[model samples]
Target: MMMLNIDDSGMARPYLRENIVFNHAHTEISTGTTLFACQFDGGVVIGADSRTSSGTYVVNRVTDKLTPLAKGIFCCRSGSAADTQKVADIVRYQLDFHRMQMDRDPTVLEAAVACRSICYAYRDDLTVGLFVAGWDESLGGQIYSIPLGGMLLRQPAVTGGSGSTYIYGYFDREFRSGMTKEECAKFVSTGVALAINRDGSSGGCVRLAIISKDGVERRLIKGDCVPRFSIC
Candidate 1:
């Protein structure tokens, strides 16, 4: 039942009672990160900013957002840190078991599907999104974006998180098919740096993972080394 209060003006104002139910998961929690994956000619490059925030405060300055799910597959995470970390942990365990049973590395699509299954199951309880990128013998390289609510899309280039909103136009103009490895890396790094400069919730160093048939190479571009552009 609702409680009503009469003010000096004699107007009744209804208020929720103590017994009313509220879903905390639906509450807004400010989260920040810049994540993106670009599929180049021979492989894929995934990158993310290191800033982790809660509301207006910066919590972690050097958190790694790129998580390894399989032999050559990795995911870029954004959203609640605990939620994304737990989801990645579960997906990694399942993929490891699948690989052992099949005596081969799990495919990129298989890994992405595993993530989607978990994310979909907890869609209402979790606020997380992932970009799955990897290289396999069958498919040279692939990039799959599994956003909130578990919707999956395969794209040549994709970006996410708060910082992404500032770089949509940048990607549209710079991204192209058949890009070389160096070109792709530069594109990813530049785009992320741009986001960090503009997004208050996104800052810190840029972490990158370049995946190909050879293996995965990790790179850390310090904040000082990140490119800056004048927005004025």
Candidate 2:
């Protein structure tokens, strides 16, 4: 099977669009909705749609893709839910061990690197895309994108999953550095809302989290109310 490569647009090239063609187990690659993270003045905001699918069939409508790995640290999974959950568990254990060994909290960058190393080692066997976000005393807030094959990247804003292709333009036009937490929350919520409306693989509810100096705060944006954006 040919390894998948995500193009600049965040879409897998046509050859890899449906991982099903490569192998049966890889079918979960087509199940993504959208998961993204962005920086704000006070912290970072991470959001994801709740839909989980297998090909055209919806498997779960209330999946919480955004997971708290630790206090002030969160990860949003976008590919194979089982694979992502396994990796998240491994990374969470490592983070806890590191803190106990070193007597301090791990920084966002440290956690990303650790997670990437693990993902890279298992790249041939696992399919997963992740967005890591957190705040620390030294770095107020940050977000990282970790795609399959373990490409780790730091971005002010990033979107992953199938719905990402539909909403990239909205983020490109409205994103600005130094946005307040409130502004970032609204922007991310709106982006997920739009993605859910237009992308079949994306729907259900919008799960959001804000990671600040204190810790991570979570919220849920109802899917039924998202259509209001069509008028606004």
All candidates: TM-score = 0.86, 0.84
Give the candidate number with the greatest lDDT.
Answer: 1
lDDT of 2 at 203: 91
lDDT of each: 0.89, 0.85
lDDT string, candidate 2, 162-186, tens digits? 8999888998999999888889999
Provide the global lDDT of candidate 2 against the true structure: 0.85
Stretches of model 1 off by over 4 angstroms after superposition: 1-31
Q: Which candidate has the highest TM-score of all?
A: 1
**Candidate 2 RMSD to the correct structure:** 9.3
In model 1, the Cα lDDT at residue 187 comes to 95
